[model samples]
Target: DAMVIQNPRYQVTQFGKPVTLSCSQTLNHNVMYWYQQKSSQAPKLLFHYYDKDFNNEADTPDNFQSRRPNTSFCFLDIRSPGLGDAAMYLCATSRDSRWQTYEQYFGPGTRLTVT
Candidate 1:
């Protein structure tokens, strides 16, 4: 089945170390998004890519960054890991249309643990 895939379902990193989470999809969707979700809190939209265009949320911290080199793959880069940054990182893809509403499909997510 064509769907989103996230690597290294669980990751452990030392404080101040850099870590990268990856996501890919076979669905060939035009829009890809990254979200940070903490337990018992609402998921926060970090950024998204619509084709070659990149959009970042105004409140997203500078520590969070994303890269989409191609349509099928996206990367989330954390410049410095912190204990407070430990959370589930989700990757989602959507097909936007003027004719109909499209739903976003999310991957299982990558759980990050900062020591």
Candidate 2:
């Protein structure tokens, strides 16, 4: 089935080390988003790309960055992996229709473990 896919479902990194997580989709959607979710906390919107136009959430930290080289792929780079940064990183895709509605399809998510 055409859907989002995340690589390295489980990642182990040392604190202060750099790590990258990747996401790809086969749906060919115009919008792609990255979210960080911690245990018992709501998923936080980190950033997104709308057909090459990158949008980063204002509250997102400087340590968190994303890159969408093309429509089918996106990457999340954690400049420095901290203990608190250990969490599930999710990638999603959506298309906004003229009807003013959007439905997002999410990937299984990449879990980062920082030591």
Candidate 3:
């Protein structure tokens, strides 16, 4: 089945250290999204890139960065992870972002740990 896959399903990083989480898809979708979901909170859209256009949510922190090198792969880089940054990082893809019913295919998220 076509799906999104995340690497290093569990990640451990020291405080203030940099960590990179990767996501790749087999669906050949045009849009990719990154979300952060903390304990007991709804997933918050961090950013997304459509083709080569990157769009970031207003409230997303500066430390969170994303790169979509190609149609099938995307990476989320945390420049400096703080203890509060510990959360599940999710990657999702959709065929197109302009559709009202843009249903996304999500990967099993990467859980980040900051010491």
Best candidate, lDDT-wise? 1
Q: What stretches of model 3 exceed 4 Å from their correct place?
A: 97-100
Question: Mind giving the per-residue lDDT tens digits that candidate 1 earns over 1-115?
Answer: 9999999899999999999999999999999999999999887899999897999999998999899999999999999988999999999999876577599999999999999
Task: Give, for candidate 2, the lowest lDDT window spanning 10 residues.
Answer: 95-104
Candidate models: Cα lDDT each: 0.95, 0.94, 0.94
TM-score of 3: 0.95
TM-score for each candidate, following the candidate numbering: 0.95, 0.95, 0.95
RMSD of each: 1.1, 1.1, 1.1
Q: TM-score of predicted model 2? A: 0.95
Superposed on all Cα atoms, model 3 deviates from the true structure by an RMSD in Å of 1.1
lDDT of 2 at 101: 52
Q: Please say which candidate is ahead in lDDT: 1 or 3.
A: 1
> Could you give candidate 3's per-residue lDDT for residues 21-82 as a string of tens digits?
99999999999999999999998999999888999999999999999989999999999999
Per-residue lDDT of candidate 2, residues 56-93 (tens digit): 99999999998899889999999998899999999999
